[model samples]
Target chain A: MAVNDMTKLTLGPIAYHWSADTRRDFYARIADEAPVDEVYLGEVICSKRAPFHEADLPETIDRLERAGKTVILSTLAEVMLKRERKATEDLAAMETPEIEINNAAGLFARGKRPHRIGPFMNAYNEATIRWMAGQGATHICLPGELPADAIAVAAKAARELGLGVEVQVFGRASLAVSARCYHARAHDRTKDNCQFVCEADADGMPLRTTDNSPILRVNGIQTQSESYVALLPETGELIANNISHLRLMPQAVDMVAVATVFRDVLDRARAVDDADAMLRSVCRTTPFSNGFYHGKAGYRRIAMASPA
Target chain B: MSLAELICPAGTPAALRTAVDAGADAVYCGFQDATNARNFPGLNFTPDELAEAVVYAHAKDAKVLLALNTYPPAGKVDLWRQAADTGTRLGVDAFIVADMGVADYIARTHPQVRLHLSVQAAASSPEAIRYYCESFGVKRVVLPRILTIPEIRQIRREIPCEIETFIFGNHGLMVEGRCSLTNYLTGQSTNMDGICSPASEVDYARHDDGSMSSRLAGFTIDCFGADEMAGYPTICKGRYTAPHRPEAYYAFEEPVSLNLSRLLPQMIDAGIHAFKIEGRQRSKSYVRNVVSAFRAAVDDIRAGRTANIADLVALTEGQKQTQGAFETKKWR
Candidate 1:
């Protein structure tokens, strides 16, 4: 097991507002067909999204667990309100699904209980990872802004501390989160009276410059990259650096098919070129970018060197 | 505890002296390297300059807090460590840090130095603030601009650390320490590289329509009208068009600065200990004007008199201001 020959695939927490049926259906399909080893459920972006899917959570968890998927609950990404604090505490007290600490509030609420640190918590270096490990962090999904060299160093440091290092492999990269909802504000509504307009844009509303160039995607309070980040070509490099997990953030796409492509590539059953082709076919709206890992503009897609 | 302290910014030694002479209770600054957030050219101070500034400020009964806030990559933490060592030897009153690694380095190496949680850490809730106080012995936390006065009171009641809130200057709506918009555009991050909208990559051009467009790394951030005053292209304040809304608008935030002068009394009543003015990249005159205005306002509040806000309007960004989330009545 220590050999780490194959890295595991994890579905990170959803940061958008999806309807109850849509979420239930999405998780159902993922539970039935996705080859992901673990699935994180719950809201990480806004607390408002919690009520919409709170009712369907148990059924969704049951379905995912029945399929032998390791289901983990994710805490809020930015906890400020009193209700948010209580909600985080309640999430930490849950007995079944493990908790992923997206905000530092979760770390404090969860105390020394074993948990997974989400990318939003700013696990940038060895000291943070080591500190989280001391506080009973078993896994850490580092921030997506890290380049390949930073990722390698963090992965090595995490391994030394006996923790799993998970990096986001595919999805519209998150750029920022604000207290005020840009999605609501854009629709001529305040954050309080948003009326859940974000649900309309399944993948998030595309924001472009005056020249109509796709620049960013706005999901309620969160800002994301217009281009989806695909790391199918960099799996070999990630594995070589001892990365234990690859996180595929849930997007409004055929995620099951997306997971199969990653699973096949990791299993050595499909070539990287074929997988990349399959990914392009599934990803329709946004261009593919791997620039963050390359230490360049996040929207730039660097052509990987042909498989070594 | 008697009155809220006036923490001001000092981009240079002149600004430092200006702020201190203007009745600043403390001055926060950083080194010129990428170890600090304001890594702009011709800004910040060297070790020797900082030592001199500290001596000058201490003579005026003002404190100097060194900002080693930017997160260093795993193997590249030495620069931050070295900054902390230099800051300690220079006799800085406190270290404003965001990354846990930086805080840990400061805590373990120089346990006596006071540690303040930078807004970049985005520790908004009480539990989050408690985590830092429990882990790194952080003495103060600079609250993000997102919180309300009531929220601050609630956190102050729940947490053990002292609280500092930005009273004026850039009103960043984005959650601090978490934003990557600058990195997405310029391949640089405010948290990681200590730069946002790096001035080197910023360009301004006049459109064919006779409007001015501010660009960040070749991407148009915001286009200003003929009569409009164009502010620096902070990515968050940029106007952009979305698929749902074709017309360009300030989708995230408008080009306005925060002036919490009206709510100074409420903030003080909320147990806010330090009132930080955010603009380390600004000038000595701007520093003197803002610090003097806020200093007068704080004194007036203590003497139970009217604290005027109109006197500071000329210094606000784009000549516009907002109470921000502190006075925000909107629900989220």
Candidate 2:
């Protein structure tokens, strides 16, 4: 309630596998054109894709930082094997850019160092957020599954803790992360020999219900919503509350244009309805969903006349 | 001569007593509240009943582990704190916790109480497990059902805590303590509200062809053929259609219960300290039967004899069973 017009815009770590050139070009564009204030850089989904883009991390970080954007390196969402553990340690060992922790292992590796808590860390309540702050988390991105009321509650708690609260205002909502790769399994390929199958689906493989209803999306081990979470109608309430940072997850769309529309709505230069229409036109992604923000089914889109 | 302890589930006080009398080494349950994962209707013990159940289990030389595992809402952590406090007062053996806040509270409030990292924590790596052990003095961890025998063996050598594993029931493929598919449909999460495929929303209908269709909160989860046994309407078990596939298939996982009875000896050799059976919503007869059967198996393994595994086919959900990810990682 004491915050400004709205929160700063932040871009979450990309959860897909884009080609090396695509990753380079995407960050290049994000650094030069996007309206995001902070950009998270790293492989947060699968470790196999890290090497493909790992070589370009320095350039990407430099590009973003030189463009006056804060950079945070994110760790994998679920770390299990020795290789993944080493990857987390490597990220923690970095000196220039701070780390965003998605797995609990990052807490151990980044001992006492200031870090950001990614949405995958499950900071559902005040106690969890405060504990993360006590452990040196500078910012905490609450999961997309939280309703608007829960978001406001956590944002207030984060404000009290001096930790920024981030909400995922765009992109497909991640539902679950598993050890098995359904993307690879679908092709009768094992995870070890996945052969980079997930790269084929630039965004993510769409999974529909038996009636051809888009229900879930598979990106290797992570299962996400088949719909994109749109919060244009509720951004006012989010700003009226104490949300500190609004995160726009990178999807396979005209992301710069998408961010432009969101930035315009935040600046009041465009009405929410016009911005929503522009967003829908630019994002050739899935249907819109505001269910998680309203404490309803996550895949449905519901119109609200008044904010809670 | 105590091999791995046989841990069983008990939703009711009667079931708890039945498990203890049937020869369980330990029985785990939760209070009838959101603090536990099995927050089903007409299931779980009351706080007063838990006190009596703990006494009964202790009298029968069985341990009582209270599951206070669900993640509380942003401002409503009192429910979880109260559950932990009440369980501690009842003299439970260990508290199964998932949320970092709840674990921190338990570790600070009652440092003497044993804390077991619930599978809901999804701490699969050695570093994650070591973090819990170092931060909260967690004595044990219920390993998630996503690891293989070799992976478990390697993890055991690396972590400081004793490992408890699910040996039977709910071979759920979705990562435990992390799934929100149920919430995506019914607005109730297994991690927060502790209910999934909630009974209030589940409906079953018989088709004209004698097949059965199961729905959860008005969404069709799955349908079964005439001979195919129907399963609970969990989102993961339902068939889905994708653009790449022509017909609907089990995109997530099939309806199969985890039956690790055949792999008990290997698991014991793999250095598991406790073998857990999941099913807090089951009946006392089911608890008694399962406890008695697993008791004989663990006793046989202790005596250096091959355990005679029972055919629990009839008791399994969907009338199907699988070794799950414990034997291999390709159950899908």
Candidate 3:
């Protein structure tokens, strides 16, 4: 496989809760300063929060586009409500930019509209990738939990099918999404009156086992691994697999610095040493891990220190 | 209306015959590989066993549905493709598929075989189901266990396929076909490996306080008192303490079986084409008892008599039962 200088960096849509201003400012700064190739902007979490930033989406999209970034409108992770369906349909109808479908509802609504298949769509193999490409998908983000061998196979298939492949490069991996909101249920409130308590933690709350070992993170309805999925050490394998893009999900702190480190690693490959030092400087919470890429237990940490 | 079909799970060849003799209208089983969700060792049939089981079911005037539900790991599509071919060659009635690639493979190559979208696919809406039907020629869809009766009725009016629902057995409140929490904890998933808390990783220890703790991969999933029965240690059914909750509670769902015997007539009236019993990991006696009870209830409902089905509650999870996402969403 040939590595291309056009290595794309995609800013995956925020998977955690943030206040309206915080979200607005994060994207505005991403638009102006971040060295990203594409920006996926929309509410991928609870539908109740969408209305908070719904009015500002157009301005954000415009600003990101004016800053020489390709903007892809994103859809919700799960679509069960009437308003959610309408929101996905409205996003599919937007003519300004392409859409990245996170669920089957979004894929159905797009219906051959030439969209990007988000990681949540479950395209793990060559056959599924070919099917999605045949359905007019131009880019396919492989599922976050898939092993590296699978990623290589999928990247090969994507190259043959003439589509782009993107992998999560940083941030807490989204483990699962559910219809029931544990946050609201924990607070003794129904899903209807959740009081938007998930916004208190800009990132999700750390979930530890009864033994007090950090194991997971709980957002509104989505559960994520506590270990931040860092793919910086596997840059060589990713390049060998013909992966065209790497996705970085938005976190609460030092996001621009995070993007800059990835940019340095992608640009100067071998010149960028000390993966641990880079991660320690940029990460605000949780230790960095790349075990998912090595096909080991995702929670296990692989030694990335260069041969001393 | 025609005779209501009773679909039962068969983990092995002996279980398949047991379910058939118990008067199951159809028996669903999986191959001994990752292609099926019930990928337990000592359970599920080999290719030769499945061929013989299908012949046995056909002789008994019953059908066999082969579960090829797992999403094929990348570079291993050949295994799933071969499983589809083997099922079709053995004359299985339908292929219950969860992956788009598997569905497409069966739809294109073995067009003669019937395709039933497994609940794992998580196609919850009319549009999503309709897309599968229009694209892949799916004949039936195993509806997810999270819909209300009214929701199922509304969906039936929209899609062009038969609907098979879980009438009794393990009821998963979480979205089917999308959960990997089990694999996260125990390194095996029902969707990928067909085993949730595989027997190798599970252990039961009696605590000093007379409570039994069931652990999976060194993590305590649940603990039950002396009188309370210890259910299987699945991630979803495990008790945990959240931030706001003071004590340990079921953060996801309580361990409860879904007994919709009381709602059979309502489901039938709502246009359900089949009623499914969900214990592939159970004993032969359980298969015989549950199938016979449901068979009698369906016949009684057809004969216009008051159907009674309360004795089966003892077999439910936690020794209690609930209508589960059927009556209303307020149970949450």
Candidate 4:
């Protein structure tokens, strides 16, 4: 596939604080088996998780790149601490394995060096994307909440600026990131001594409404949807609008098979209905939602009308 | 030591007058349209009212900082552009902006008007603050309510722009400009649409046991007992259940307000250039009371006297308040 092709499948950086062994194995499988065109590596959620997986980054990058995948290093989404700043600076200084900046600190440190704007960066509109392009951003991942109309506008602006536009096609949509760690707070602990409680729930800790309905998932400081955003049916519209890439955030499921299903649908070798069933089986119990694309509540699964 | 300027919220023209009269150094407000974050029914100032507000505030020796903070949707950049143009024409002392596109437009077109980075920008780190300062010539940045006093002091030392920290009202625990929780449930973005848990989508139901439940778009945000003081069902402040806990709890933050009154002396000593108060959706009386309290507190601290802080528990949400993330990072 061409680098700028609309069918390009990119894997987003893991938002959960998975163990180093789990991360290594996950990336190894993605490198050798997944049909993804690009792979985003590094910690995007909590800064504390970086140390656990930073040592194995070089090997992971090499393996992914050797497997003919374009590798992108993602920076932390919420940068506040001294070490977080230092981490962003160190990542910004890197000349290889293009950086995906999630915070303005990365934008500052990178300073007009070509990079990708991560979904957390809030490239919500044409003006923002244009300004991002001016800041030397080569690609922009539109925030998951943006509806179809907004996506069309943003994608057109990005295309006009000669920048790649990517949208999250599958995975739990990140809703919020805070300075305070709800994951630690949930365990009755402070972030300073979080004891890596988030590692126990590799996908994310399930957070339900008071009435026993699961509404959100808490991963450290970040809040995400309980349902994975599956936009396979909307891929045709996205491609027609010139969206350059489709992103899949790594959940605790069989992501390689998930990528294969999306690839098959994108390639038109399989029907969206068939791929949808395949994804449901691969994900097992997690529900799929496409409401954000349809401009409804993110958790609502707006079913597309069946063909005549 | 130079006393930190007391910036106050003015949701309406009446609120603006009340704030100015109550000794606000500057009153920040937004237009009635979606250009600002406080987009609610019967709140915020019209352009003509803003023009009059500028005059009224200027006469009282207080500045009017226009908030054009929300991100302009695609193909609708003109709304924000026109807002900047109107604000410049109306002689707004500064433009409180969040989006890079809006900031860039203001900096380029209205170079003479000062640009204050809204907390909605979420420029928490020194590097992030410096980028805004250098690129857009931002004069002041309203720091997000997610930093500790030590972190603010560190950032103040590193950055060139003035730092403004929230001292009272609305404990904004979530990282602003980045949160999409409200959007996820309501399909109205807090960053793009400027309202969170919009009143229009909110519904309250009464149960047989004399209990009440508040919801947003059919999703149960929280339920309250008869004796409990029910707060607005904001996504962050609502109660939730986790597997680790036995029952439902305030998963994100409790229904509490942020009152940094006790930390006034320390905040002033830390070289904070301005002290901000949230709640542009509040009433004129709320504006008057908070501004008056903070104004007196700031004055007392500046004069080397112990600040006689007023009890503001009645005005706080759920009748509770916290210093929250300002005193320590362990508040989580």
Candidate 5:
């Protein structure tokens, strides 16, 4: 498929922990094979894990850019440490490709250069979007939990302002982020000595209710929905609303195929049913949901009858 | 030295007067809508009640802070906007706002009314706080109960706004302003709906084996034995199972209230301008007791007294308390 015909797919920053080599190899392979248009790279989860992959970051970015994929650096979702702030400032200072501001630290650090605002920055209304656009944000990813109506309004506003708008199309919704690490605390370790045990769960540790019902997924300091969010059929609606980018969050499964499925659906190369089947085939998990878009329970499954 | 403002929660008109009579510097309450976090039935004030409460609070020299903190749903922002307008016209001292839209609206329309960033906004860091200040002209920020004194000091040094920290109350370990666990289970969020476990959906039943189960939306969140203190059915504080552990554990957080009376001097020195006590749904006696205690405690700290406060433990959630993420990040 021609790049112009393809729906822009951005690989959201890795929200889970992985070994440095694993992270490096994953991005390298994504640059080589993933059907993504752009890739956001950085430590949006925890600052402690950044140093492990810091050395390989530049080479990874180079590889992705060399693969004709746009690369954007992401700031931390919750910046607390001075070192974290310094790292964000460094990212902002670099005249690299575009930057995604996960928190306000990046916005402050960006100074005057145009940047992208990640969903964590909370641009709910048009005024907020306009304010962010004024602050040098060229692209803005609306928060994951915002319903379609709000997205429509923001997307309209973004269009009027000539800014790019992105939305999460797949992967578990990032529900919340905290200062405390439940992964470490679960293993009887403090935040200071977390032992980096979160790396053990590449996809996030599953949390179940007392009666053993799967309720949530714990990825380091962030909590995610247990049900995956898929929007293969909503491509037309999103496009109609002026959403320019479809964000595919990094998961443990076949993200490449996930990207391809979304790409085909967006390009009208495949029907929504075929894309849904292909997605199910590549998915290592169960049940897809798009309830947040419908303003219902986020876990509810909204089955689309057709690609239209 | 300025007396540390004692902001108290008043869920009802009676509670408002109780807090005011108990010497609260300010009483924060919410309308009986989805705009505030404590949207429990029989807890919040109606429009007339709020107007009366504002008059009552103003007469007693205690300010009224209207909490319009919930994130307005996509197409339903009118409710939040109307709430803000009502609060402004009703002579509210400030509008405690969490959602950016609400803040932006209040800043644009009611420029004179003070705006306090609700802890629900979860603007924990200095940069995040400054962004709010720079964008919306927020006068004060209610710091989330997750920062240590040193972190608070650092934030105070950077942000150009007055900082209010929770001194005694149910300290949430979960991320403020962004928690959706309750919404996931009960289809209502503290941020979006101003409720955690709405009373209408909560049910308590006894099992045959002498264990009691607390259910929210037909899903059992936690089960406690007869001897155990049955806590509220919040999904985060509920017991959960993991593959490694055979027994259930509090995956999100253990039930604990934040009591930082011991850290009064340090927090005050850290430039904490106001101290908030957090229980709006409690009894009048609770309001009177907790408010007077904290009011005296702030006075003692200001007067260079030892600042002894021990009776607060009984008012804590699950009858337990912690300094929480205030003293140190790792408080086990």
Candidate 6:
């Protein structure tokens, strides 16, 4: 049951605007209990959420680092306002802990300094990954929409260039980001007068189709899938393709226990069926999906044949 | 201020002629493949047709900007590279590119050719625009539709390359080259496949309640009453129900087109170099009327005369239009 030694488990940035106390507690639990090797921190969806938690960043980073987990700060996925530009500049100027850039403005600000490419940045092909490597990208988390074959090709290209390749294996898939904040607009509020309404739905507001089918989630300006993307069974294929990391996006579930289950599966200590049952129990109401990896509709649940 | 060049869309060669003849300074088109953003079926140009289009456009002193804007999939860069080679050989005026790979290839292979950053690249900030201009020698950037007038003016002052903003047509507020909403439901995407809510997967069903539901791949996007006009269900403009709201709402945007007709003078004063129209899937009459109207308007503004705005609600989607975010940040 031994996996690739480089196949580390990573936690993506929190895409929601949780209260500063809640964020501190979440990071404290993750720092001490989770089996993940890396943790990404920042307010990636909205700039308005940064100020509420800025004073507590040093303690979170120190705790994660002290617990032997690598910490990476992420930039805003969309930078338009003057404050956002300044924030990207300030983060890009840092030289200590690494920065994961999600927007092109961060790329310009970093300017050949080594940084990680967040999943929000589109790295869909070998040519694009190679070009990013030329721009000093040391690691890249591929876009969530890319299919399996494309991931294999991109992973191979990245491996050949000595860059780390990571793929999201758990949690809600981020589908789209917009200039306007849908979470606010849905509540009859403009983005400017949102009043931090997104802080209500920590897991994101549920958006249902006309027939009342729960299909999508609205997280501030981002649109995400209702089902969590679980790829526990496909870890073998991902490792075979030379992927170096598996990312699990932070959600409201018991992430410490969730990370333990994934770690058990990765370590060959638990059977796939047992792990699947455990995950289902952990994520009670949400469904599991791997259709994006199977080259079908992302929300589809293509049943996989049992492994030999 | 100098009159800004009018850039128009041409899905077919006939539309190309119509645009140029209607007073478009330049016409943007794509091959009948995934290399361009508007890779719709039965639309776009073949190599032979593109050669003829270049000749016809050059004869009338109009420029032909070939759009190879979609991202090249892994292990399939040859298609985009070959398309670039074809466009270069066909004597196109410039290339509108979105992917960094395609931009790098074009910049390295054909240094003499001009490169314009497509809106699909989502280069909304001055720093992002500067990165493209410096890294790949991109000469012009079609700014995304999310910026306000003051933001555009500030960006124009900071960046070195020419600026192009959408003046009419699709008010796609989503950051281009990044949206995956359609792909989440249909397995196809605008960034990789050059289609959004593709027509092939779209269907309409009449319910027993005397209402029709517009769907993409069987997911109900919106239901229209008998008297209400049902717009095409592009994912962003679709209506959906949320938990806090009692009724379905346009979570992203309403069904309307962006018509910045009255802001021509202010746009010119903001140092915009080109004004772009965003409908490659539109008809020949649409091309003619919109192009001629904007042509006369640009002329009137440059000549210090008040431009007469025309009523173009019929040509817009849902028979309605708005000035969108360009007028104010409050539209969000």
TM-score of each: 0.97, 0.96, 0.95, 0.97, 0.95, 0.98
**Interface root-mean-square deviation for each candidate?**
1.3, 1.5, 1.9, 1.1, 2.1, 1.0
Question: After superposition, which runs of candidate 6 have C-alpha atoms over 4 Å from their true positions?
Answer: A1-4, A306-308, B311-318
lDDT, candidate 1, A124-145, per-residue tens? 8888898889888999888999
Model 2 segments more than 4 A misplaced:
A1-6, B205-212, B310-318
Compare candidates 1 and 5 on lDDT and give the better one. Answer: 1
Model 3 / residue B128 / CA error / Å: 0.7
Residue lDDT tens for model 2, B104-127: 999999898999999999999888
Q: Is the docking of candidate 6 incorrect, acceptable, medium or high quality?
A: high
What lDDT does candidate 5 reach at residue A17?
81
Candidate structures ordered by lDDT, highest first: 6, 4, 1, 2, 5, 3
Best by lDDT: 6
Using Cα atoms, each model's DockQ against the true complex is 0.76, 0.67, 0.51, 0.79, 0.51, 0.82
Considering only chain A, what is the TM-score of each predicted structure?
A: 0.97, 0.96, 0.95, 0.97, 0.96, 0.98
Prediction-by-prediction clash tally? 1, 0, 3, 0, 1, 0
Number of the top DockQ candidate: 6
The 10-residue segment of model 5 chain A with minimum total lDDT is: A1-10
Query: Model 6: per-residue lDDT, tens digit, B202-249?
Result: 998888988989999888888899888777878888889987775988
> Which residue pairs overlap in candidate 6's backbone?
none
Per-model lDDT:
0.88, 0.86, 0.81, 0.89, 0.83, 0.90
lDDT string, candidate 6, A1-308, tens digits: 45535679999999999999999999999999999999999989999889999899999999999999999999999998999999999999999538999999999999998999999778889999999999999999998878889999999999999999999999999988888999889878889999999999999999887878888899998989999999988887888898899999998999998999888888878887888889989999898888889888888877777641
Q: Highest TM-score, which number?
A: 6
lDDT of 1 at A204: 91
Q: Specify the poorest-scoring 10-residue window by lDDT in model 4 chain A.
A: A1-10
The clash tally of candidate 3 reads 3
Which lDDT tens digits does candidate 5 get at residues B157-252?
A: 788999998998777877777776667656566666787767788898898888998888877789998898778887777887767765888876
Q: How well is candidate 4 docked (DockQ)?
A: 0.79
Better of 5 and 6 by lDDT: 6
Instruction: Report, to 2 decimal places, the DockQ of model 6.
Output: 0.82
